[model samples]
Target: MNVEKKRVLKIFYLIATSSEELSSCELAKRIGVTERTIKSDIKQVRDFALDNGAVIKSRRGSGYWIEVFDSDKIQAIVEQLVIHFAYDSSLSDLSSEKRSNDILRKIIAQDGYVKLDDIAYELYLSRSSIKNEIKEARKVLESFNLGFETKPGFGSRIKGSEFDKRLCMLMLFEIYYHKAVLMFNHTQLMNYFECEDDVRNDIRHSFLKVLRESSCHIMDDYTQRIARYLILLRNRYKAKYYISFNPEKKVLLKSFKQYKIACDIIDELKKYGGYDVDENEILALEVFLLIWADIDSTSDLAGDYGEVYFEALTQLEKISERIRQEYSIEFFNCEWDKKIFLTGLIPIILKIKLNCEKNDMKSSVLFNDSVRLSPLSIKLSYSAIELLNEQYNTKNSFASHLIIAYRIYIIISKVKYDYSPIRMIICSMHGIEVARSIKNSIINKYSEKYFAKLDLYELYEMRALKYDDYDAVALNYPYFSYKYDWTFVLIELIPTDNQLQELYNKVILQGYQLKQFLEFFNFNKNFVFRDFNFESMESFINLISFKHGKESKFIHNIEYELNECVIKSIYNKTCILFINHQYVDHNIFEIYQLNEIKNINGEEISHIIVLSVDFNHSIKAFKFIEQLSHQLVIDRETIYLLTESEKLDNIIDIVRKGLNSEMISLV
Candidate 1:
């Protein structure tokens, strides 16, 4: 049945079975379509109902119901519709995407040219609808370098290299039948492939057995993909369609270990199904297995294949570096992560370089909405594409970019939770035992959960220690005379429940505040200047505040604030000048390594670090800058690194580490 007729039948069944009358709006909602579409289908539904011994009754505003006269005839019609068109009711319209896939499949599956009328008749669509869907299908085919040729009487056929055709076919199968195979819905697979249960099971067994003997571990989804490819290959071969590989390229493929594995699989197929596949078919299967299956070792692929692996690794390193430079974040911090990323990336590189078809059809539908929302992921994907295109001279499809973006998002998200511990100091007037007791209680409750480090200290030691060394300071008695720069809270000697809970909340808040503060320190190379020269403080401020085009009034406000604020010199010889200002529209942080030391008010300045925060910035931003300024004054090593470090990444790393150490104080 045509899609419209099926929809019309569905509407009649709904009105016939519904207990209450359904309005056009209500029917549209239930059917997952617009009210106008429901209205359009209503006339056809009325005609269908009348032919099936029922009449659809409609009132002005009351909506639709059904009146059945011939009960037996109406019952039979409803039963047939339920059996065939019931599953389609929940689907919105026969969407253009799906219709295109159907049309593409029909043309590809045919031997020569497929008539438009035959497709329209088979799909129950009009000539016009089929033509529109053909355009969409043509775009997809063109991606694989396949051509859609249509003549007056002969209709249409996809014209491309056999390899490209198979690739397109593999992509289509992945889109349409992968889920069924994944679910082990054998009946659905059998019906779709037009194969018997025995034949399907034998093909799966043959593929798995070959993989097992070769010690190859294919992911379950990929295993299903190969099986589907084999089924399609058998059908295509039966129709006298075959893949032909280049003579030289076929010789190079035979040297790979996968070629042997493919031979074994073809041997099993011939054994079980009594069918012989050509050498080109074996080479094609080899390429499929190499792309989809995971082998135990790359040691077996020693020569040309190893060169491909190394080339992919080189491209990956460049892509990773580009991402790091652009985002100021590492793509993969560990070797294991790099290996995982490289493994996933190699197939994409091969798919592009070898002109292999894309099989991850679901990525577009799965990630289109979510990927656009993540600018970082989108940027990372573009970086990867740019690098890959530079290296291989081929552009990735939109689907490939989505897959890369999805992977990048997963890695970046995992990096977000790498938290630094919050350091806390407990002081008691009584003795060490009392301080220990308070520390133990807090640790037992919140230490592991909140990633806190608690240390016991005597109240007399408070005057001897620096407050900036710890994130929070808890005391048994209120010592008003001694000033504290850190978060301060008082408790009883034993510590009350309320006091401990308050301390826990402070620890959590301090950690969050520190994390927020550290985010501003993540500087890209573009923001870092080396050997910078400025004649005066005014020129320096203007240079730092310089943005492209007309500068906002906010930039002038920032310059005013910086000019009014004191620039403190932390060291004598290699003076690290720190300037922090507020009342800006956005947070700004930059470092300028001076070409020549300048004396300002008899203090020599070698490096200048400028920080500006929004007027309505959080307390965390203020606290972070305050703590960092204090550390630069006290910690000589940090100041030395700030003035002396030549590499931009190292400088940024040291700044982050210095601030983290001030807050965390990890033992």
Candidate 2:
């Protein structure tokens, strides 16, 4: 039967077995089909039931149910359908995913060319269906570095390295057979492989014994997979199809301790199964062992495995550093978390380095869904894959990035700090008690919902206070003077509801300001250039100018402002150069660490801070830029931190801290 007919049969079976009426929505959801498709299929089901001594009844409010006039005939129909749909639900044509998988399995299982007509007949599909599935199967084959070859009359075959072919076969076997259950019964194995039960049992027993003797901690699923691989290998070797390894790689594999384990398993195979295997087969087994064997810690990876262990550690550290430099987030803070990540990461790194990475569509879809939820994690994962590709000289796949990003998102979700807080100052002229009362009331009201740090100050001490240290000021007296429009909330001596709400609104505004500041800068690593050189001031100005073809005049205005208002000073070990310009359409900020000291206006300078702001930009954003300029000239510690920080994220954090202070003054 075709897939749609089979689906209709399955639907009829569901309706017959259901205790309650099944709605079109429920049936569609259960069958993974649309409600419209379900409605049409129900009509087909009704017609088929009428022909087979059964009736499908439906109501306007309720859904579908089945009534049988001839139980024997209905039972016989269900029995025949069960043979096709019981073990694998994919036998029903729902989507191309399973069909494509089946195509891959059929091609990989055959020794030589397999005809399209033969596959179509076996799958109960049309020739067109098989052709469409072939395209998907080809994509999967290409990912495994295998080729799909077809002839006019001879049919199609998979072509690739023997090692890759075996890997592809193992992966497909995992998808098709072992997906439902980790363990397979002796009868199932014998029937599937067409081998004697004793041969399958011997292979399983030998693999388990070798793994146990080597103190390898592998999951049950992987153990079953290894057994399946060995069974397939034995069959392939019997067919005179053997694997060949590179001479250099074979030598390297022989030196590893896993090689001995591989040898032990092969010897058991030869003794019990009467199999003939060679050194190349042993090397392939060693590679499998290397990829699958789980090590709890670096100490567990003794002997030749130590090289892979160390390389995994180095690559992990590089990824961690990249995340930190770009996002200002700590990646590996806890040693336990590091160990957990290392254990999971080692296998993947081994897979990539050894060219055995499995591209499972289900796993890729799941990880991609999870990574999409976190925008920052998505960016970090992309950056991480780029770093790995550069270091290894290999093009990693999207699935690889998704996997890494999912792991990174998990770790970061736990360690990332809540950096948003509204700093507020509470003052009163009525006395300290009134000030304390108002502060306590505000804290008791908003502490749970909003993060606000409240401090008490006398009204007389306002002039002595550093305005930059607080975001909002609450005072009983209304008379206050400041250059920038500060968030001021005038509270009553006893604090009325209206006064408290005003204070809360000011806190909300401060939060908005903080958010805008962060969004404006964004703090991309690309903004910071290290060891950059420019010969003259004109060249540097032109390099920083925005490229607008028709707005050359505006660009010239920005360049003129930058040259006119540039500030140069020698601070500690570096010459700090600060350049600020206004009247631009958008904000631009960059930091440059010169390769050597340059003479700009006869002043030696090594570092440059460029800030360009739009005249129409938000006051809060402009204040932030102004505050940063003020810090660069007067704050010696800020200068030291900006110049001496190794990671761009550290510099970003420093600047972010300055911006968060919300201090506004004349520049």
Candidate 3:
């Protein structure tokens, strides 16, 4: 039977096992699907069960129930169905979402094209429904930069670099398995991946043994997750889908200690488990270990990233400095904050450069919502974005920016709100009357928002006790050290507003802010030339003019106009020179890169920005540049990150979304 028949059989079995009649609505809720879908499923279930020794009886008022004449035959048929749906079903069977995920796995697992007709037949869906599934599969494949190619006779296959294909397959495993859609326990998963029962048990034992032999501190749960990753890796290779890592890239990963251990583990799997694993798969496993192990700043990312690791570090350092300068908050002081920011930021930077996925509009909503909750973080985050947009060649998607913002929010939440008001347990020796009086006075004097909650506890019960559950202790009686760092407030029989104010000051810490307004500047890539020499800077303008077949004097005219605008470094590090030319044939706004140059007035000089406007497109360019300049002053990091790796189209798309100007034409 195909998946749809198996589903209908499972539903029928459920109703048969039930003592009472079941309504379609109740079954739909249990199955996590629509009532209409359940009704359709019931028709198939009734037809399939009738010849198989069970009759589904329905009355006018009552719902549906099952009656069996030959229990032996029905039990035999049900056993057959269980064998068919093994490892993919639960107490309940697959829902529509789970079915879709299964279809995706099937498509990826196949080494060659899988026919749409075969898929439809197996899933018990019409051609149209299967077509819709294809669209979803394409969306997922496109996000990984894999091609969902189809031919008239050849059907379809996901095409991509082997490295990316492996990454996508592993990510799919993580998403579906974590959600319990695959519904396979460790041993079952191994069996599904084609491991023999003995081999499966040995692999499990060997994986744990390897972890023990090495002093790795991964928990059992994480060890299991890694084992699942290995299953997928071995399964893919066994099916002839292999990943080949570049020899140059492989050399770079040798610096990581985990890489060596991963290699040893693979060797053991090959020796004992009767599996053939490739060198590239071993390298990929190392990447998975680093991410899943949750390594902090102590991790040598250079093993996976090569020289770019140091560049990423410099970028993170610059971002931290901006946050500290703008918010007056320190991050490095808190080890948790430092670890989180670094671990999250490095992978994100690599993903952006690789253009691994498309940005969903929903992630932008999350970014905005997070910023709304914290107002001060916005200025610093925006500043970071602007700097990144201006400096990097890479294009950052809104989703990418949102992830960066989330990491920043994690750090800022610790820095900004760590001293928020505490919950209190009020204790008094004078009985409930005195405690009530103090509590009422405090509540009426200050809003309940200032404190989490106030509870009354008797003084006698406070002996030899530590109130660790509450944030602070409030009492009128004398007390000794309880070994907690919480605020302890004592009030008189009647407390004054002045005493309340002092206590409030101690409870609520002061926030940080910039003493002066910081200004920013925006430079287009055409204008940005890193380590530029004077002759080369002038040569680039002439080359552009010559390429457009314009007059040589027009180039000289641009040089003359450059004097009108001040050329200075906006970040106090790199100088940018920009010129807006009048009435050119093309509306050109290009950023040019230059190799580093020294001995220009005994100081390093780089970046030449050109933002030229044609007579007709002048208004649009002017409006866009105006908005760009504003973004530069407030948030340079946005510009820097956007420009650093590459994403001009995305940056322009962001600008187009933000600006509703009729005069500004992005196309």
Candidate 4:
């Protein structure tokens, strides 16, 4: 029993063995507790006696009395309790048989519909116990044509013959699945989820109905569960497939597991299937499998348990690629990941399978009291973000729909109806935009008064990439507004190297490029440079250098007139002059006055340009700046270190405009 139950039972035991008929107050004083606690203990003792076929009688004027007629049953009862707790003993080690019967009982009940957590939880066991139990359960139920199916990370189910042990397994599996799904649907995991519990309830029974209908001997019931476990492992660690859970090894696998969940998927195949699966080459294929399993697990995102969710699209490409090579099949799983957003329940038919017969594109980003939420909603939210990221860059199907849903989750996570706000921020940061967009739509669309409760500014800023701009103040007006300039600018820097939507998103490319971006800019300080921020920082630079032949995407308009009448030579290309913030700020024409204006890239660099602009200068003022013949020399790859100061934007703009002096009077 849990600690609470044990403590309560101890109090009850004291009451049961009391010799005198003491008042609850007196008993409470003796036990150093409140009288109410004594009363509760008496009631509990009576219930326990009744449950155990004993008797505990209570009198209104007197104290409570207990009459024990089944002392022998106590020993047997404890022994029975022992059976439930036996799994805990073998947790660290693998005593396979101890957990077999417990798993077997559940397996017999649910026809291949049990959850692994149920198996683990029912016997007071850990995941390893159930995992070990699978081994023994697999053998004992093998001849009976019975098998166990596990949902690893979720729960376990069973399937087999009705008259057979397998039949019993099927019943047990259903029982576990129904209970778990009920808990999942009823519990408030996601915030502001107002849709009826009935929404999920409506199809739950039907889902079980289908499971019963389709859960035949298509495969060994045990095999199906083991297969699911393998799939779970495969999905969770696609890029990293090895399954060594050593505490030290866990540290090594931490990064690979968190970001590249499918990093070592070949480990499972090598360990279980005994195939020489290549760990690295199989990463993409494993990514596909992870997405596939995620689709099955994240049914609510697509609004259909019967259909696949779009959030699994990134993996679908990997799957498509794998199928082409491994199975010589093309376009096998592409249709499912291509679902458009705002469509009917077709996008998320898996959660409420019954309501989504008709697909509708009229979907809203806001929950708006229409979308119900549960614990699984968090899972769906995560999946939606992954899917949206995949969809955003991958351009697959109606993927943006999932993005909206993901945003809704982001907003809802912050506005917890019952959960703590601290928890909300932690969960919402990863999908900040989703939260911000959802909050805004709710405030405007349905006139939600709860807008004030949300950290609207904080949420929006989280979506922003933090950086320094011209004075580092972002201008958000007309259509919208922003307090910090870099809020939008920082948007370009991709933070934490989130899961890749394609090959380029992988660390080998994306991380490498980002590392280069930081190193080139000498950006050693901490900043959240969103994708837009990285691409937008070139607003001031004049010499736009393109990588792989793309022009430098600049952000600011050139101002001021400093007729540089000079041509400075650089290492590679030809440039009129090299300049800094001071050159532009002072409008100093000394670049031409110097005997030699050496390019910084070249070995000889005698003079430099600087631009200095007042903090309040209008961007439109300095219109007479000298123009360079090669105004397109600044490469997007140029690393510009951002410093936090009042003159940040001015300094950056100086280099940006290629001004020889750092002072400028642009306004």
* Per-model TM values vs. the true structure: 0.57, 0.49, 0.48, 0.18
Clashes of each: 1, 0, 53, 145
lDDT measured at residue 549 in model 3 versus the true structure, 0 to 100:
30
Mark the regions of model 2 whose C-alpha exceeds 4 Å error after superposition.
1-93, 176-192, 195-202, 268-271, 274-276, 298-304, 330-345, 361-379, 390-393, 397-667
In model 3, the runs with Cα more than 4 Å from the true position are 2-60, 65-103, 177-192, 196-198, 201-205, 208-223, 297-308, 318-340, 349-410, 413-667
Best by TM-score: 1
Q: Candidate 2: worst 10 consecutive residues by lDDT?
A: 182-191
Q: Regarding TM-score, does 1 or 4 come out ahead?
A: 1
**Model 1 lDDT per residue over 510-623, tens place:** 454344434555434454568878888777777655641134655675465346432322243333322223233345555667789877655677767655433122333333
lDDT of each: 0.63, 0.64, 0.55, 0.34
lDDT of 3 by residue, 1-667 (tens): 3557656866786677678988877777765678798788888898877877989987756678988888987776666454334224444444444455445665765668888888776555578877876776676666666777687897877788776765566555554343332222332232335556586678878877776786344545557656766676777666676777676657755655668778878888887643567677887776555433444456555665565566667777787676454333444456566556666566555444434424231222343443432222333344455456555754444454445555665564332212234577676768878887888877776656556667787866655456566666566776563334557677656887665654454332211111111111232335333444446444554565555435666666555534322222222223333433332445444444445542333345333334433322222233344334334333445446445755444344333332322121112
Model 4: lDDT of residue 616: 23
lDDT of 1 at 191: 36
Candidate 1: which pairs clash? Answer: 2-124
Q: What would the per-residue lDDT of candidate 2 be over residues 197-274, giving only the tens digit for each residue?
A: 787787799789878988556656667777887877887777677888777677756766888888888887787664
Cα deviation of 273, candidate 4, in Å: 48
- Candidate 4 segments whose C-alpha is farther than 4 A from its true place: 1-43, 50-67, 70-98, 149-156, 159-163, 166-667
- Cα lDDT tens digits, model 4, 277-365, are 33333433332222222222223443332124343444445433532332122322223333322222222322122111111112223
lDDT (Cα) of model 3: 0.55
> What lDDT would candidate 1 get against the real structure?
0.63
